[model samples]
Target: MDEHKSLADNMDEFRKLIQDLKSMSITMVDEDQAVILLNSLPKSYANFIDTLKYSRQTLKLEEIKSAINAKNIENKASGKSDADGLMVRGRSDKRQWKRNGNGLGLRTRD
Candidate 1:
């Protein structure tokens, strides 16, 4: 094949293949189901998806799941939160953290 196809073109071809699969008697697809599936991904899974896409490395579903799970555990252990920057706890009245690494504002719970 002399013609080179871009990532977007290959993705379109893949989409067409999936759509064609929907026409088969045994296969079906629902946009609502797809949206729900995508929305249900954990933060780490979403991160993993981006990493996988960018790295262009082939990996199994199990491998991706394990990686995401490990990352989630690590984040939980570090007192870091899935929330946006500057995680605030029940005490907003508490003084702001210092720039120094003393307490580090890293308040992980056992």
Candidate 2:
């Protein structure tokens, strides 16, 4: 898995790899597939992987895939994914009300 690529891209690659293996008559258990996917994640996903890996319940490939997809959505929404070129953060501060040429205070609030 490439850390430089987005989670979606990595997941796609993983799916392709699994497809190729299936074509070659390679078979793996669900647990093994989940483990492989978790292991293939980037270092940024270490915490997520550990959380899933150490869970008490048996691992399911579909669940792992769902979690990855959810995480990808979250990262993209927060501008934290590798695929995002820019990150926007909200800032809140107080500033003195200044009058402009129009004789009105130039202040905007949310």
Which candidate's lDDT is highest? Answer: 2
TM-score on alpha carbons, each prediction: 0.34, 0.70
Residue-level error in angstroms, candidate 2, position 45? 0.5
| Candidate 2 TM-score versus the reference | 0.70
- Scored against the true structure, residue 64 in model 2 reaches a CA lDDT of 94
Candidate 1 lDDT: 0.47
Over the stretch 1-110, how does candidate 2's per-residue lDDT look in tens digits? Answer: 98887677888999999999999999989889999999998877888889988974799999999998888878878878644444587766655677789999987543
- Report the lDDT tens digits of candidate 1 across residue range 8-43: 353355446556767785463343323333334444
Q: Any runs in candidate 2 off by more than 4 Å, and if so which?
A: 82-110
Model 1 residue 94 CA deviation in Å: 23
